[model samples]
Target chain A: MLEALRKISDVVWELPVTHKAGMRVPARIYGTEKLLQEMDEAVFDQISNVATLPGLVKHAICMPDGHFGYGFPIGGVAAMDTEEGVISPGGIGFDINCGMRLLTTNLTAGEVEPYLKSLVDLLFGRVPAGVGSRGSLSLSRTEFRRVLEEGAHWCIENELGRPEDLARTEEHGRIAGADPSLVSEKAIDRGIHQVGTLGSGNHYLEIQAARPADVYDPELARAFGITLPNQVVIMFHCGSRGFGYQVASDYLKVFLKVMEASYGIKILDRELASAPFRSPEGQDYFAAMKCAMNMSFANRQVILHRIREVFADVLGRSAEDLEMHMVYDVAHNTAKLERHLVDGTPRELLVHRKGATRAFGPGAEDLPAAYRETGQPVIIGGSMETGSYLLAGVSSGDQAFFSTAHGSGRTMSRTKARRTWRGRELWREMEERGIYVRTASWAGLAEEAGAAYKDIDEVVEATEMAGISKRVVRFTPLGNIKG
Target chain B: MPYEFLEDVATADIAFEAWGSDLEEAFSAASEATLNVMVEEPGAVRPLETREIHLEAEAVDVLLLDLLQELVYYKDAEQLMLRVDDLEVTGGPPFRLDALARGEHLDPERHRPRVDVKAVTLHRFRVEKTDRGWRASVILDI
Candidate 1:
């Protein structure tokens, strides 16, 4: 597989269409030569498989953080013809709309450091975590349906967040065309008590600070509502919990039967089962997927509310005094319709981004008024021990269809990490480094050891050097709540 | 032996192979292995209650996937970390699975949890009747 790749540039490699038979388009991978050499052979196989899917436009692209996932590479971005393309659930992943949200606080790390342990404790107690963890809110069948249809608006209407927050969120915190009737009863039951909860394995709520040394572009940082050194912030990473999982599970079966058995479309991997975008099965999954997308938006919104309450309780300060405002929220795993110039012609394409973030450049019509000049905020989270990053979209990103790497992709497997490190020891080590940590299961924490992932700094650098994204600021972890 | 975990399969997920004298036992062992991934002790889960499951699929492999997915649904929705107390399978053009699951809600004090098994993946999923017995291999998205 490595021998088959042709070097296009310092940070790009091409797998020609002739590399594999039946490939509709070529596969292009973005990464440093060192990164490419270390990549698993399975990534080549997976990306090649994705290129074979019908109606793919231009090329099948993998971001710098790419890794071998079930059907598609984790950081893969593929655009298909809206009128004749296919929609595969595997292309979107099991955790629908799994993404990140950043909240900027007026308080400094010095002010919060005194109460960091207490704040983390309060957050851990307030926000449920781990498998089968239940939240404070319980919805009936009817109310749950509303949550599916309305998304974050339901949370705002219930007074969980301010109306202004909608402006800072991707898709205005709600994805329309969510058909609640299409969601399975089992999915509803799983989602009823899981909202506002953070599930295990990589989901986290971390408190961080930005020092002047970490700021790459001061003007852009200030424009993003990030101020001087020591400014504190909170980041929440989660998704639609069990609701989205069941939705994907249910639809995958339907697609397998319909696309394969009925439509007679053969796929190399069963996990890549899909239906045409205009087909009944595809449209139904799209509508149902919107419900999961909205559900995730609402889930993160509720967690934000809980964080605010904890800050107030721990600091004995009013919400107004704290001035904790949402910076931005972005979804990584989703398929959305967007217009991009394809060969100098504006065409509507269905873009599927799995384990990748939308990094639309400045002046993109979808951006908020404040960000119209600077571009969208791209949040890239790192390990608990390592640092995170804040970036902005660059016009050059349009070349890759306006998508970028999601995070410090894992280098080691969960099993290997668990075998190499003890979670209890890792927790103690973090505390010794002045980084507070709280978790439900120690083994779960072991699976996310910092050593398990590539250096976030390097991954972010590769993306910037590749002209896919630009660095705005860096965040050093102060404390965290791991699920 | 009914089942044994296969450790060196995939980096992001877990996989196990199960065997039985016939199809029913292999499916039952597969359920046990799935439960063992979540809890420290599979037998520690007392069969305090039982919930019945009835499913129909076109093939045996899809039937196994459906049965395992049903267990995951019950775990997340009802908080029941179930073990297959009884299972019956009838293979035909329309394969069928009727299962009786038994367990209690997950209690942090009693049950030591591991990685949460999100869903069963079709990524290298298989089921076959060997010369000696029926065998199945499945990979789970955790």
Candidate 2:
């Protein structure tokens, strides 16, 4: 598979259309030589399969963190002409709008270190987590529908979020065109109480410190709100939880029935099931997807509220006095309509980014005023045992339609990781390294060992060399609460 | 043991293969495998409740998928750690599965939690008959 790729650059490779049949475009992959070599071969199969989808422009893309996934390989990205292409649930993923949110606090690592354990424990107890855990808020069907329509705004109206936080969120935390009627009763029933939950399986909230030495770009770091050395910031990774999962599952069954029968679209993989964008099935899924998107925003906003309260309580200060302001929120699993220059012509393309971040460059429209000159912040969370990064999209990012890697991609499977690292030992090791940890399950803790994932620094470096997103600051873990 | 997790099939998720002499046994094996993915100790979930599942799919392979998905749905919607007590699979134009699943509401302390199984994926999903028995392969998104 590696030999079949054309070396386009030091950090880029292309799988030509001739590599496989039914491909409308070639496949563009971003990775360092080592990263490409380490990539699982299934990514080649999946990305090529993605290239075959109708109306795909430029090329199907695999980010540096690419790995084997069901339909579209995780870290896959593709831009399709809305009028001519198709919409796929696989491309957006089961966890609709699974995203990352970062917040800056006036407190420094030194100030928080002594109380890190209490903070993580309090958060672990407060935030719902693990298998089948419900949320902090209970809502009737009617109020949940409002959450679907209003998104984070509902949280703001309910006094869970600050008005200023909305602008910093992607799409202002509410995707337009959401029709609650398009959502199913099953999806609502599954996730109605999950609006504020941090679901298990790679979901977590962490306290980290952005040290002065790790600030790759001083100006960019300052602009993104990392003003103090060893600035203690909070970051969380989650999505719409079970509601989003059910939404994707429900639509997959619907698309499997109607994709070829109604729209005559035949996909190579059953997981690649899709429908024409204008078709009734496609329009309805898109509408419902937005609702899940809103549900996710509401979910994260509520979690953010909990984090603020916990920090304030542990620190004996009001959240406002601590200046726990949001830096940015970015969704990795999603499809958004954006105008991008294709072959020198501006066209609205529905860009599907699965496990890939939208790294729109500076001057990109819709960016908050503060970040307009700096570009949108991209939060790539590493494993709990490793440090994470803050990155800014660069102008050169448009080459891949402004998409970048999401995290340190998994290298070892869960069973293998569990076999190699004991959960109790891993926890002790992290403790020795000055990282406070709280988890719902020790078995899950073993599966997330740092060695189970590729090096985050290398992944971020590959994206930087590829000119998609640039490094701003690196934050080492001080505390972690894993689901 | 009727089922065993496949270590390398899924990197970010979990995959398993279950086997039995017939469709009913195979469905039960797959059900237990899916249950094991959610809880480290399946024996901890007492038979405090039961739910009846009826599903019809285009083929036997999809019926297996649907059965596995039903377990995940119960976990999410009802917080039930249901495992297959018994099931019957019927062959037809639309394959059918009828099962009685039994388990109790999740007790975090009693049932050691693992990752949540989001959905059953179509990637490499299959059901086949071998020389010895029926075999089903599933990859669960976590």
Candidate 3:
């Protein structure tokens, strides 16, 4: 009942446009044969479904880490005509603006290794995490609304972070056109007390060891003040918390009813419900979604401030000497207005990257001036046990809408994983391997055991071989705090 | 009928196994199990009135989501507590459903808050039948 896949190249495979009805474009998957075979067949079906959406340009692409997801496979990328296309919540995913951030510190791992446990404890005490977790900072309804609008800029204005930090963040730490009025009351209530909290499941704060001195670019490392083989750095992965969840929830309900009545777009799945870009409902959802994205930027900014305080207090070093500089921040789940080449002609498109990262190549005008020559930094978070990676977008990604993999995709189902491993045993094993972990639930630990995911090295290798992004540095985890 | 709860870090999946000669009974039993994930008491709410609800879905998985979201919408927006009464699923290119839901006014003390069903994820979703009756397995986006 399925068509045979056509091999486009060693690192590329194509599902011809005719494989599915109503397809506007073909589907291209970037990965090696081994990685491709490991993927679930459902991924092809999902990607093909994405291609069938109206006004889809070029191809519907799946990164090496691609896996089965709602409408767009996780790690899927697609560009649509801004004037005539549609936007689906399934394409951006439920966790709007889920992203990663990296910070460099002056202290070497040797200096902090002795007090790593204490540092992890302090961090755990400061940043609230876990399911239904609430933070110490309680915002009045008005202040909460302001945070939804101002984003990380609000954090910097409140002295939580340095103003310069915003320059290194995607979209300068805030996306424009966010309308707080579009956010529902239920969404506002859900996010009011959750600003600085880290909601459970795959969100974490980890301390990692930098790559060997010779492996990193000397000039860039020096500019970023990152040096020494055993340098201690902080990396975290989280999102807009309850705010993003509520935003997606509110819109999905609205879209479900409106899409049928307005556009006559019949989807194969309710999860893929969508509305035309020109519709009022679509514009409102985009604005509200942007507000949630800004809220996440502020959440991570506050967490970074807390990390700085803990480092200064425990190390007895001045904030200046700690030299905690934000290297980069990138979102994994989002749909943005971008310019891309469509059939050799430049056009504006709405690019949807669900569980994928925008890896714009060097000299992109949108990149910060400092990074113009090197390209945007791409942060790929591996499982806590395997550590994470820092990569730079390369020129070849220009042909693929400038996107790359977000992480090592899930390989095993959680049910099978929990049955095979015990939480306590897994915790002890990670500690024995020199990775300290602080978590609120042991059951959660078992579900996220390293064995549950694919090999990050192989996923990254596939991306690199496909000319999407190039690895700059590899980090080994020393300690982690999970929600 | 028996149901088993499966655990995931982000969401929880439960498997409902029921035996019935007809489709309506199996649908009723499965619906009961699905709501059971959110509350401890299924029979505590007095049946004040019965309302007929209809839904059309593209697949069995989406039908399940549409059914659950309808219940959630009633609970949140309309302040109604509901349990499936009579239900039927006619599967085709577009699955059609006819159902009745019974519930009373909200008694806050009787119903305790559980995990929020943020969204119905397509991750690891399955619905199949066994020798006994029918089974539907789903992962809720919590």
What TM-score does the predicted chain A of each candidate obtain versus native chain A?
A: 0.99, 0.99, 0.97
Q: How well does candidate 1 score on lDDT at residue B13?
A: 66
Which candidate, 2 or 3, would have the higher TM-score against the true structure?
2
Per-residue lDDT of model 1, residues A1-483, tens digit only: 667899888888899999888788999998987777656677788888899998899999998888767789888899999887899898898999999999998999899999999999999999898877889997888998998999999999999998988999999999878999888888898888998998887889999999889999999999998996889999978988999999999999899889977676778898888999989899999999999999999999999999999999999997668989898999999999999999889999999999899999999999999899998999998888898999999998988899999888777777678788998999999999989999887878888899888788888888999899999999999998988
TM-score of each: 0.97, 0.99, 0.84
Question: What does the i-RMS of model 2 come to?
Answer: 0.8
Which residue pairs clash within candidate 3? none
- Residue-wise C-alpha lDDT for candidate 3, range B32-106, written one tens digit per residue: 655554444656777886778898877765676677656654553344667887688897659898898998655
Least accurate 10 contiguous residues by lDDT in model 1 chain A = A34-43
Q: Give all candidate RMSDs, comma-separated.
A: 1.5, 0.9, 5.9
Error of 2 at A390 (Å): 0.5
Query: Which candidate number has the best DockQ?
Result: 2
lDDT of 3 by residue, A293-318 (tens): 99999988888888899989888997
Q: What is the C-alpha lDDT of each candidate?
A: 0.88, 0.92, 0.78
Please tell me the TM-score of chain A for candidate 3.
0.97
Error of 1 at A302 (Å): 0.3
Tens-place lDDT per residue, model 2, A1-483, is: 788999999899999999998988999999998988888899999999999999898999999999988789999999999989999999999999999999999988999988898899999988988898898798999999999999999999999989999999999999999999998898998888788899998999999999889999999999999999899999999999989998999999899999888888888999999988878999999999999999999999999999999998998999999999999999999998999998788999999999999999999998999999999899999999889999999999999999999999998899888889888889998999999888888989999999999889999999999999999999999998888
Could you give candidate 1's per-residue lDDT for residues B28-134 as a string of tens digits?
99999888777666777888878998999889998999999888888788888898857888868698889899998887667777667788999889999899889
DockQ versus reference, model 2: 0.83
